[model samples]
Target chain A: MSIKFKHVSYVYAPATPFEQKGLDDVSFELKENQFIALIGHTGSGKSTLMQHFNALLQPSSGEIALAGHRITPTTKQRDLKTLRQQVSLVFQFPEAQLFESTVLADIAFGPKNFGYTDAEAKKLALKWLEKVGLPKSIANKSPFELSGGQMRRVAIAGVMAYEPAILCLDEPAAGLDPKGRHMMLELFKAYQARGHTVILVTHNMDDVADYADDVLVMEHGRLLRHTTPSEVFKDRAWLLKHGLGQPAASEFAAQLAENGLPLLPQPLTLTALTHRLVAHFKGGE
Target chain B: MTKIIIGRYIPGSALIYKFDARGKLLVTFLFVFAIFLANNWPTYLVATLYTGLAIMGTGLRAHVFWDGVKPMVLLILFTSALQLFFSTGGTVYFHWWGLWLTSTGIVNAIFIFLRFTLIILISTVMTVTTQPLAISDAMEWLLTPLKWVGVPVAQLALVMSIALRFVPTLFDETLKIMNAQKARGADFNSGGLIKRSKAIAPLIIPLFISSLEIAVDLATAMEARGYQGTSGRTRYRVLSWQKYDLLNAGAFVVLLILLKVLG
Candidate 1:
């Protein structure tokens, strides 16, 4: 289902001496099966905005509609719990949230809290672990014993076990090696393949360019632009002004274009860049 | 949901800071004991004046010194009222509803209240003047002798230091969780006790989960650094008692004896 926020505003430590306005009249919508990437500099309210998607953060003065149901402070407990389950959130460092004795138990925590039977929860856990490319053998071991990447995989498995319609990941590939990062992105691609709506919050422009179907650029608690990757990349000056780095491959293409080579459309990936260069030499004939 | 309070200890280079932590600890204990022993007006007056001067010497404001007294206000008032009604052996001021207020009772209440206020104020001075890490370091060093008795003093101090560090982090996390739950239409404010408590359930679940994560990260960091229960570890920061500490301790003891003799 789609998630909608109408004019959301949030403040950290409201009315206290430490109070800081984190979001200012922000509004956006995530349509069903849409893969959106939220990118901004640190403390630009990107995290604050993403938190609102899963109902982790409430707007100080706006309304939210999840799956066509109006979300309010007086919403029923059962309804809120179900809403949270539908929009699963895997935090930036998922491994930090591991607490149960075994990977299986940690994965089952969310489902069990929502009243899943033990046996049923275990079955779901096993399936999600495999879905994340981890084996069932890792299920019974303490989550603490797993390597960093494995821990993250199990943590994602825990969220995937809930089978949310909307999967919101906060910096999923953060702190991973290059290979680990690629594997994690591939997992999100698989999730998208299954027709699940994914909202990925990241700072890496390359990740956004390679995977994000929709890109929303935020700067200083303000949404500067919300459009497709091509549209966002077209505004090169604006992106640079807001502390956002351009995709490395696209930067190279732009440099080539400056050197009297017309690369019609800048390529963001290395493979596409290679193809474009080959065509330029062939087209020279 | 651990109702943790922030620790006092401002870090700065000052004369009071250079003193050994063990010396400071010993001196504080002696000062508190001496303050408690002052029985009469002259002794109490002298103790209060000395403490007030010492508080000013620390370069902290009077407000900082008074913070310790704030939390004990209710207890001080209660104890005063109890003394005014229950203490006997003096001229009676009034009698009503099985309660008697005597002249001695009034004196006792005033004395006890002043004593409570002054002592709390002095302790507040200690907390504000010393850095918490420094104090913990001092505590660990002083308790090293207890290692022979299998006392995990260093470990205890490490736990305290870590807990203190985590307080602000956890508080920020708690606020985030609360706001998130609130966004989902969970009313933490404007509800009955049960309803408010119920509303906090979702927030607490995530907060606890995050805390577990924090604990694991901290443990991993500790393990990575070769921490294995503080055995045979040489401290980077060493503390030493100086001549000033010896004089300070002796002066305090002499002052206590003088007060007792005069009383």
Candidate 2:
């Protein structure tokens, strides 16, 4: 099922001096089982929009349809556990949410809460632990005893253990090393391959280009565009206007095209760029 | 989380809002002592009238004052109920295991409830009308006499203001942490005492860690901004006494005179 929004808007501290329009009458339909990238600069309502996916923050006006549930401003917090079980949200710096004594226990937390038996929770936790690239040996250790990156993985695994049909992440790989970032992106890509929707919020244009089949571009509390990633990166002027960056490969291809070595159907990833470059040179030969 | 409007100030343009922060702070501090001066019905009535006038002067709706009283209502009722049940004297209404309701007990209970409610309402009036920054500034100005005793008044004032600011920040942090845990299917509100506490552990740990991180970051940022403590600093917000501020103090003096004469 697709997630749908109709005239959703969110206001922070309404009717007060500190009142601000967090999301301004946004509307979008997101299809299931696709990797969707939510891209925007700071204070563009990306976080606000992410919170709406699982009814963490209700719309100030209008309504949302997530799975079979209808969420309005009156959707109480108690009624949202079912929705949250279907869609897990990994907040920015998810590591800070860790409180379980052991990494294993922490990873099993979501599954346990979602009604999995201890054995079943443990099995899922161990499975996702290795899937997220953590060592099995670290499972017994206190989550606090692990490094920052390892703790982040444990926290991510914690939410992923229940195998929610939809996973929502806000900058999940932010602040990681480049190698770690690539591995995390690959994991998310693999998770999406299992026919579950993965909605990600990231500033990295390259990741969006690499993994995102759909791109939702937000600006100043408004959804500027909801289209394919290539279409989004195609407009260099719009990206520049919004202070957004380009995927390195597309940018390089654009420069190559400008220098009279055109690679048609612009490359979005390194692999695509390599193939395009090889074909262009081979065709030249 | 509790709706704590006790220390919250709503900014508005009113006569009470115009009173100098220093005078308001002083009056509020003395009012605590002044409440005790009301021993009899006449004195209590005078105190109540003064409190009523103060509330009216704020130009705020009654609900704001009601909110100030809501949090302490249970405690006041419980204490008043205890006094109503226990304590001895004239005409006995009830007798139990070493606890008896008497005429004097009823009077004391009523007085206790009145004193607590009036104190909360009047303080609420002061807090609601004055900005937190103004309160801190007034506190610093009032404590200036302690400067000769080697007190770090400016630093203390800075600490007090920062603490006041963190109250809201900590509350927001608590909310964020609670939501994060709730996303994981941790049911905080629908459980027995033990289960509820277990659910809340996630929130407290994260909140505690984040607060420490925030404090450290704040200290580093302050150092980066070259915040040297209490050295050659000039006041950006100066406190000056106005005619209305004098009227505020004068009004209190008149109330105290009335309280003494009538009680």
Candidate 3:
């Protein structure tokens, strides 16, 4: 397994007046190169769970094994650097983390911090900059000078430059235009294709349907379900009862089946729905 | 991380919470001044009892009050220890190398310690009971006379209120930045003094930039809403001098006078 969480629980400000249960008895495992989508309502501990993968937060109880490193509540600080270097986390609005004088330097920050020479780190940053679709001309410009979307891409490139073994992202495409969101999703998919584990926490069910291989549903600090998108979205009533919605295509296809169209095997992605409808019409003719 | 109780007003309907912010401010000022007038054990005892009563009247849990006093405990101890070892008067209890532990020194230590504790407690009670908005309003009203002498009292009050409001917000932002940097393999805890200071760049630069962005956005929002810095503005919640406010102020004044007479 690339990552394993065993009965992990995290409490913020434990033993204090503001103590909060961020995650409770959460256990799961992910294999190498698997694309997992974490779906939940706001404050449902999705971010809290993701932070554990890189040891940014230690589980208050239980343990987590990520990329061969074991993390528990008493995990030492010196040992966490290896875990962090192996599993990179791109936070919500990752653009907020960019702080170097230039875009190139900003992207090079992670690599250099992980023990790369200055020149090698800049080279890796330049390569990832192109991978994230940012032009090289802007590499010399200050990151503060870039647009919000462009700055976000630079921040993502900064993390990707280090080439972590397991990449975890929290709403990586939030507040982006449709094209930007599509490009980001495709970039993450490509990263996974290169044999790295990818865990994504997002509210967009369409992206989840299109990209996620496994769906982990979280609610009220607990893992409500861990299944494939096809299986999870098939139980529309159960998902709705839990205050979650199915993918747009899946819901639309379900409505068609209820109205006597009978698209057995509900379609999740738009392309799948279109193919199913085209086959139905062709078979009818 | 328990919301940093400093300068925070817990919402409640206790008698202390019901008192006007202006009255609380005036009483807190008088209480701080009265702390210095307390010279002997009896006066300090009365002062400490008054503080305890004031805190009790707020109906806040004893622990909440203790949490406020917790950080100052070390400082109080240090100040009292300094007085105990240094102040030279009365019958000497112990003679050490270049230091005298006398009965008067011990008394002086107790008096100074009680004075510090009483001042902190009174200020904490005032802040915990009164909202920042109310404090700003009371401040502007109290400082209105300064406006006659060309001081921008209203603007100053607004600045103070905004600063108070951002304390919790910036604290959260700092935590977020620290976590984000940690996720990127930035080890803040393991490094030495120089390495630790160097590691602060990632945390501080983002915080500074985000704060600037937030300030700009707030300024734009205020300008859009026609904020003109106290020019031709009317109060939404005007401060009124109520009966309880009068009582609260009168009670504190009487207590101070009694302490003075008794001391």
Among residues 3 or more apart in sequence or in different chains, the pairs in candidate 3 whose N, CA or C atoms overlap within 3 Å are none
Ranking by lDDT: 2, 3, 1
The sequence of per-residue lDDT tens digits that candidate 1 reaches over residues B1-263 is 12233666654455555556676676776676776777778887877787776676677556665666878899999999998898886899898887888999988888888787877776676676676777788788778899789899888988988887788898978775564333323456666888777666666766887888789998999899998888787877666668767765665677777778866
Could you say which candidate leads in DockQ?
Answer: 3
Query: What is the lDDT of every predicted structure here?
Result: 0.76, 0.89, 0.88
What is the C-alpha local distance difference test score of candidate 3?
0.88
Q: Report RMSD (Å) for each prediction in the order shown.
A: 6.2, 4.7, 3.0
DockQ of each: 0.12, 0.37, 0.54
**Candidate 3 — which residues are off by over 4 angstroms?**
A258-260, B1-14, B36-41, B58-109, B131-133, B235-247
Q: Which stretches of candidate 1 lie over 4 Å from their true place?
A: A15-17, A69-79, A141-145, A177-179, A235-237, B1-5, B8-82, B93-100, B125-131, B137-263
Model 1 DockQ reads: 0.12
Q: Per model, how many backbone clashes are there?
A: 6, 0, 0
Compared with the real two-chain complex, what DockQ does model 3 have? 0.54
Model 2 chain B: weakest 10-residue lDDT segment is B1-10
- Fraction of true A-B contacts recovered by candidate 3: 0.64
> Which candidate, 1 or 3, would have the higher DockQ against the true structure?
3
